[model samples]
Target: MRILLLGAEGLLGTTVWATAEADPRVTELVAAGRADVDVTSRDAVRRAVLDVRPDAVINTAALMPADLCDETPEAAYAINALGPRWVSQACAGIDAVPVYVSTDFVFDGAGSQPYPPDGYPRPVQTYGITKLAGEHETRLGSERYLVTRSACLFGPPPRSPRARRCFVDRVAEKASAGGDLKVVDNVITSPTYTRDLATTILDLLYHKAPSGTYHAVNQGVASWYELCRTALDRLGLPAQVTPIQEQNYTTAPRPLHTPLTGTLPDGVRRIRRPWQAALDDYLVQYPALRTDERDVA
Candidate 1:
């Protein structure tokens, strides 16, 4: 299947491109980063989608960090909300399925249980709120669409220089250096591997999964503390990791618990590995995580 991928240099987008390259099913992929088409411009998005004329368009571009989104809400809304609207409209014109890569932030983490894809969203911060709006725009704008929400991504560092470093890498580096880390314990999230999420998206589309939301996160959940500790332990990196109940605040409010779970459409199979297992696969990619392994004598 021919595909058009935006944010091709990003964490998830980069993995998606690489995975598509390896998958025989992905016959052709036109990878487009911001320079190729700025989604904020309706005309640009329309032009790119129509010109590429792919069977499907996967949009992974966004103003990522929560704090950045708060500092620049207008840009956040423009890219996160309005961009999807334009892409969806363009996809509708070409009868191509539009797929939006979304986040767990869309839901307020009040509930204890893992949330289903169709669960009611009550975003607490601007990032979440804007993404939720984007979700609506995608669904409403397109005849057929897919919104896949995942969280706590860890994989190869994003190709874009501006992208934030993966959390796992940060923790791994600090721990290897014996840094004392105070990680939030109660703030739960689905730890997703970019490769896994990308694979899920592709498999879903290949199966012709019906238009709707899909929770694209790994099977299990972990708080920042547990996540870090697990990675450190697996990598044989020694450090002090303390689990605190709350994180010191700055600008944005975070949901304490927003682990995602979902119902799969019939006959559509997805890679639903647990986050811990997925992490093992990810650690293999960044062998530096095991740099201390030889030093463990």
Candidate 2:
């Protein structure tokens, strides 16, 4: 099966690309980052889809940096909301299943527990609003669509210096530079590993799961501070990270409890692994950070 992957260079998109490319079933995968296809441009997106004519289209594009979205609302809306709309429309035109990766920010973070897939999306920030709008447009545009919402992501890791800017990178940078790190303890959610999410997305596609919204976060949850601590501890780095409230760090307010959870369809299952273990796996990739067995003494 051939698959068209949008935003293939991004964190989630990169993971999806690696996973899909490795799959023997995937005969041909046409992967496009922002350079190859401008999702915000309807004509460009439509042209790319028509040219590929793949069996499936996976959208991992978004205007991230929630605070930046608030500062530039128009650009945010155009990319986050309208970009997915174009993908959905293009997918519908070619009669292909469109899998849209969404975020936990869609919730207002008012709930005490993990939010369900069926729950109404009530985003508080402009970033969340635009993402939720994208979800609506994707749902309306195509009958064959899978909307998967996840929380904080830690990978797919950097291919080059320019592309390295995920949560883990930020923490490591602060630690290495001896800069004071203030992570929000109040903001709680799952720190999803992109590889796990990518595998699950492929699984759902294989099973031909029903078209609707689903939560694909890891089985557990943590605050941003806790996640940072885990990342540092695993890397064997000693960095004093102060836990603070979300309000103290950012210009825009964030939802306090955007953690997500829901039952998965038969094909897909929640990735049951601790964030610390995932961090360990991540550290293995960076040889400079690996602890020597001889040094254990």
Candidate 3:
């Protein structure tokens, strides 16, 4: 399959690029970051898609920082909502499948259980609202598009030195500094490794899974505090971690519990490994994490 990946430099997109490139099934891969194409501009997106003429277009671009989205809603809507629309439209014109990367934040997190793929979205924050809008726009733009939602993504650091590190990286850094870490214990989510999510997506496409919304996450639930502790343990660090309520952290209203749980359509049974296993694999890939341990010692 020939694939065009948007946001190729992002946390998830980087893993997707690596995973797809390593796969024998992907015949051609065209990677485009913001430098290559501005997704917010419909003309730019359409031109890029037409030029590449890929068999599938995977859109991973988005304004993901929830706080930033809360501050600048228009930018969020443009990137997270209309960006997918433009990609889907372009793909539709060329008869290419559009794979949109969505988020678990689309749900309100009212229920204690994991959210089903078919659950109605009631987003409380601007980020979630915009992502939900993106999902709808993708569906509207193409009948054969796939929306895969995951959450709390952590993965190998981007190749760009200027790129910001993910939460797990920051946690490792803080642990190296031997500082106290305070994380939210109330906000539950499925902490997913980007590589695992990328592999699942490839499996879905390889199996020709029916086009629809799917929850692609590691097979467990955990709070931020728990995830942090697990990371520390895997890194062999003795950092002090304090679990606090979400109210003590930020003023933003976020979904308290939004772990996703559902099977992919068309009887495609994709087995998601546990989050712990994924984390272990990530640490092995990025042995730089052990630098923190050496520093502490």
Model 2 worst lDDT window (10 residues): 288-297
How many residue pairs of model 2 clash at the backbone? 0
TM-score of each: 0.95, 0.93, 0.95
lDDT of 2 by residue, 42-82 (tens): 99989999999987889887787788899999998988889
Worst 10 residues of 1 by lDDT: 288-297
Query: lDDT by residue for model 1 over 1-297, one digit each (tens)?
Result: 899999888888889999999989999999998888898999999999989998899999999789899999999999999999999999999899999999999999999999998788999999999999999999999979999998999988778888777899888877777678888888999998888888888888888888999988888889988999999889878788887776474468888899998876554444477888889998987786686453432
Please give the lDDT score at residue 244 for candidate 1: 75
RMSD to true structure for each model, in Å: 1.9, 2.7, 1.7
Candidate 1 ranges beyond 4 A from true positions: 247-250, 266-270, 292-297
C-alpha displacement of 138 in model 3, angstroms?
Answer: 0.4
What residue runs in model 3 are displaced by over 4 Å at the alpha carbon?
160-163, 265-271, 291-294
Higher-lDDT candidate of 2 and 3? 3
How many clashing residue pairs are found in candidate 1? 0
